[model samples]
Target chain A: MTYVVALDVGGTSMKGGLVTRTGEVTVLAGRPTGRENGPEAVVEAVRAYVGEIAGLGRSRYAGPPAGVGLAVPGIVTSATAVYSANIGWRDVPAEAFVPSGVPVRLGHDVRTGGLAESVFGAGRGVADFLFLPIGTGIAGAVVLRGEPYGGARGWGGEIGHAPVWPAGEKCACGQIGCLETYASASALARRFTARSGRTATAKEVVELAVAGDAAAAGVFGEAIEALAIALASYVLLLDPALIVLGGGLSEAGAALLDPLRERLAGRLTFQEPPPLRPAALGTRAGMLGAALLGWQAAGEHDVGADWPIDVLRGGSVS
Target chain B: MTYVVALDVGGTSMKGGLVTRTGEVTVLAGRPTGRENGPEAVVEAVRAYVGEIAGLGRSRYAGPPAGVGLAVPGIVTSATAVYSANIGWRDVPAEAFVPSGVPVRLGHDVRTGGLAESVFGAGRGVADFLFLPIGTGIAGAVVLRGEPYGGARGWGGEIGHAPVWPAGEKCACGQIGCLETYASASALARRFTARSGRTATAKEVVELAVAGDAAAAGVFGEAIEALAIALASYVLLLDPALIVLGGGLSEAGAALLDPLRERLAGRLTFQEPPPLRPAALGTRAGMLGAALLGWQAAGEHDVGADWPIDVLRGGSVS
Candidate 1:
């Protein structure tokens, strides 16, 4: 068995762990990703975290790493970080940041997470699936034959940018009517905050909607409608076998998925509706995806990779 | 040199040809693919055409066939013929119709056309490309790495059905506001006829638009705007290297591509606009894709098998 190092860098935090081919993760390590000083500083944090994790794993394990896979958020150029809309970085070299000889692989975080789900999570046994994370941002991962279909530049699966409504709401990307403006976690809070003049988490908004609050319910329905609109467009293009919703809004589970599923069904003209399910691994999907990719790079599975509990860090399509 | 046979079937015509691996066509044969009598009539048409073409090729050349590829319009399931909206086909047993002794393959017409373009036509050497056929209908083909990416159920690249206006026009598929209503050859004729109270062909409308006719120019500009909108959405998803417009509208050449390029470029926000080119082969793409698939099935090329062609032909994806 060989150990695989996995890193999942997010907008707010950096998560790392040593994982095995079986999806077991240990020697978990994390630190603030430190986006305040800009993207280069985040790179430093990543480097430091990876060094410590690799050192710990080496002291505890019996074999060298099989490979490493890192997941990052942004417009990736064939898994190479090109720009992060949230991280404020331009053309960050992912493989270059890691020390030589590690054989690092980089992919969009959502793509990796969706890959994890396709292999081990909710998407197991499904040949075609879409993992859409409705959180602070709305993005998707298209999994085909257990692999994510990363577009030419690896910036594929950016469904949020797909223009649906003409001249509706302005997006930060300078476009109008982005699904993110209506369906993301930030959208939920913003919608409620705009009406009630009080900011509440997406979770709180869901609770309010469930307790017979008409305004919150209306906003919730709008979010569901937006999701239905966005997903219907995707269904027209790619009829995925399953759709697994992840990230913050997904935490509401049936409260969100059930309505969204019905709304999507109502919107379909001819194609069959894909199954909607909750993401099983939640945030850990990133770690599992990294480990899974590392194993893929190694070309085989290694159970011993899990035993090195102390290992450090890490890292689409429609 | 091994000879490859390609077949493209439209609502009214069936186009077939023998092409070399270098994308050269030696023999071109065609017949009216009459579907009024249902799927069986179409199958008979295909078998008779293939027999005549393949027999003549064998008589003329000592080399064995590389492969055979077939393309059709409609909703293909896992590369198998399901229900075709344009041809009025349902559950057609395409594979049983092909001659059993040799390799044959099937695919969506536009996608296979895209395959032909990517391998031997305008999309050669393009890393990512979308082939849009603006004919009786406006469907598309997506090529990545010189191979078409057929989505789930072999319906991937159905750009025509993409919703353009929610409450605009009711399509035959029971949907409101499809891209097909604006950008297709039929759309141009319909728009012109609606404005002038006289039935006219798209070619005549284009000619009028070229000669500074106000009404014709308005319809032509509308078509260009709709094409720009749909293609812009496609760019957000895959960001392909090029957009190759095929079919009858492509006959307009620079008049269609130049203005469409300008309008699409003007609408971009986060994406870098891709160049637009006219499809090289007007109607022989399906035959070449069929031939490519046949060659692949014959173990000539390691390219994987596509599903829809499986029913019309025999081959395996490597």
Candidate 2:
């Protein structure tokens, strides 16, 4: 069976995968992006990883991979990685990531994960929704009419930076009252440390809050409130059918969803709140979405629609 | 020349017009909507106005009008007025407001105004922007990819109700810190009176603020701040190319736009704020948009693109 090489390039590491036309997935061990060495090193590392994955696909399937897809951070289009402050890359063309003859496509990192959710995860069968991943930083993928919309200049889903308090705490982005300042995973840990004078990861803080630690509870509660305020604005403005919550913090599950649902409902007076669901794909979303992009580059635009969720979730790791 | 009857139904009055296929417009005298009589009475009033305009078109052009288009408030689809709290109507079909077999279309009042702006007014040639009209109440038309978007259930574009402060003040809609509670035209007057123990229209309040009245300046400045906060969130979330301000309050011109531009810029830390422009069609946007809808119902979807701005601005009133 023919397959394609897919890579999800994060700031620290890169996850590579090969997927057949029928949705069989083979996930390879991830590699360091070598971003510490500089932007060119990161680009070379990505090319090496992609070639390695494509070589595996070729040996296994007796053919070169059909196409390559990479999900990269910062502002990106199908043809180029426009900019990424994290990796310090600018205008890196997609061709630089793969073999000369292989067709390749690129997508914005968060939006590619959102696209995977829309096609095969929580947002399946839903046309309009917001796919929000609250990781170290917060951003969203605005899915409209069955596709992710990046806005006029590819900066549309900066919901995390949209002010929740407008006059409250200063954010690292130099803004006041930004949702990310209170609600992102990094914010949770930082605020918890500030309040309790004890450092903890965001997951530990959530557990502490659930265990009834007052300081953790307060910090976590503010995060939820910030999320509610931001989401209330999102619902009023976009009126999406659903809100899919992903990212490391969403591991809190009902601890996050239950309070957020109640607070969001309380915030809105006239309209019903859209249901919020956990992201089904977890960290693999970007890789799977990259596979879809690869298939698109291979001229199989309709390949992923029929992939069973069970098979995708049951992907084998090599 | 064939024409169509176009009507804009407001809570207090109805504006009617006959628009030719080539964009010639003849506006009729306004009439009361008489919504105080009842929803059925209001529906009958619209039917009468539409029939009257069609008759005028028939007499002027020696043929029956081609179609009818009405812009009504609240939840609306092209074929139905699903709900309107202002008009107190529900599930009113488009045919109910027009003569038998004459093609008819309906649109949400605010979004219709935005449609006019998108096709022939301020938003012409822009694919994405926010068309906000701040009158006694506030609402917005989210124009995306050159069409007015009402969101998942037509409950979208309620930016007026989106909380700006999240804890500052109680809104009439029972929400806290609504943008409308501080920045709507009526809100400006009410807050000004509350602060000064004196009465003034929103326009007079703007004049007073410009003339250096401390109370008026404080109240108006708060209004501008509220608008800036709300609009900053809008820019962050959607990243529209432009923002078109309309309705009664926008007549304040530089008094509103100048400080608002500065404040909006201050609120944003990362991205450049989109340019803000006044609504070109003014109060006539709804009627002109209804005319475009009439043409759409008549199957001439491309009718409005070539209409000169001067011609649309200089329509003869009868």
Candidate 3:
């Protein structure tokens, strides 16, 4: 069977996979993003990664890889990387980086991850749901009627910048009291450092909170409250059936989810509260989603059926 | 040529109409909701209003009324009036009230108003937009891809209850600092009364602010700030192409729109701002939208063409 080359590009690393038509990750590989060198080096790194995957697909699969899919962070409008603070790139023609003559698909990393979750992960079987990744900054992927809604200008998922506290703190986006200022992983770490005068990663903060450290607990509590308010806002507007939490902060698991569910429940009065579930695929979701998009680009009609829920739940693809 | 019977049921009144297939309001009438009598009384009032319109349709139109459409306040699910605080209704089988032999369509008033705006009023020609009515309470109707989205349980559009200030005043919905508590017309009036010990309508408060009353200016300013925050949240989530404001508060017109637009501009950092415009149809939007829904129930295929923007702009049907 034919395969597709998929790449999930992050600031620090790139995950590459040769994905078969049956949703199997036939070959998986990785490489440093090399952004320390500069933007052009990052571009070259992405190109080489895709080349390696395509080579592996050509030798191992029934036919040459039919298409390539790339998932990049930041504002992606119609396949062009508009601007990505993570990659330090501006207006990059991303689709052109793939091998010539191969059909290619490009998408926002969080949105692509959301698509995978909606079809094959935690959000499986839900007609309407939201996928939120609380990493360096918070953004959401609104899945309505089985497709992601990009809004009028593809700026739909900037949930991080939504002002949760209008008079509270100034956000990096120049808005006051944005949800990301308190809820994102980076925000949790930053707030913990500011409060306790000890630098720690968000994971460390979660551990500290679990260990009953008052400072860490307070910081995490604030994050949970802000997330709850922002999510309540989303529920009122979209009425999603589920909210799938992914990204670095979600790695905190129950410590993050339990409080978030409680806070969200307390805030909603008339609206039905949706379940908050952890991302099952972790980092693999983006690459798998990119492969799905690639299959679509290659004119595969049964891509949805290819990645059945049963196979995903069994963890056979990863 | 067949006609449709339509009723826009409100807390205090029912606006009834016999509308032709071409968006023409052939006859219009009104009756007291008699809600103080009881929920059952209100139901009878709605039924009587529809019956009157059906009678008008039979005599005035070429053929008998082919269908009936009803728009009501509060949560609506599958043509069932689930709950309405305004009408004191719960699980009311609303379709049962319509005379047999006539096809019936039921929807939330705000959503049907949004539908009319999407096809014939301020939001015409847009694929996605939000319709918000700032009456006694704030609610939104999100129109996507030319149809109104009611969400999973038809409980979408309850934007009034979306918490804007976690530590602010309590709302009727039991939430604190909800957008409606600060931004809605009733909120403005009530807050003004509480602060100044003066009973005044929201319109009077707007007039006072315009005439340089410090207390009124402060209350109205808070309202504008709350509206901006709530709207920013909506923009970050749905990213509608336009936001059409209707109901009593919208009657303040430039007094309301000017400051709201300015405050919203300051909050959005990366997202392209959608235009905020006054609802073109005014109060008639609800009735006209009900009529449109009635036509759909009657099997009118060319309703979109019949509702060209020019006719709606002319205000002739009203």
Question: Evaluated with DockQ, which candidate comes out highest?
Answer: 2
lDDT of 1 at B183: 77
lDDT of 1 by residue, A32-136 (tens): 889997888988888777777776667767566777778888776433678887788887766664655776777688998887777667887787888988888
Per-residue lDDT tens digits for candidate 2, residues B160-182, read 99999898999999999999999
Which candidate ranks first by lDDT, i.e. highest? Answer: 2
Candidate 1 residue-wise lDDT, B1-318, digit = tens: 667666778788887776555444554646788888777778788878777777766775655466666777776632357778767777775564466666666677778778767766778778688888888877778776567776666666767877766556776667767788877899899989889886779998898999998888999998897788777777766668888988998999888988999988866776678888888766666666666766665676743233222222222111
In model 2, what is the error at residue B277, expressed in angstroms?
A: 0.9
Where does candidate 3 stray beyond 4 Å?
A34-44, A77-95, A305-318, B88-94, B308-318
Ranking by TM-score: 2, 3, 1
Assess every candidate by TM-score.
Answer: 0.87, 0.98, 0.94
DockQ of each: 0.46, 0.82, 0.75
Per-residue error for A27 in candidate 1, Å, reads 6.4
Candidate 3 lDDT over residue span B1-318, tens digit each: 677887888889888776666666654647789999999888877877777767766766656687787888888853688899888989887577587677877779989889888878998888889999898888888998778998877888888888998899999888898999999998999999988999899999999999998889999999999999999998988788999999999999999999999999888987767999999887777777887777777776447444655443332222
In candidate 2, list every pair of residues with a backbone clash: none
C-alpha local distance difference test of each model: 0.74, 0.91, 0.83
Better of 1 and 3 by DockQ: 3
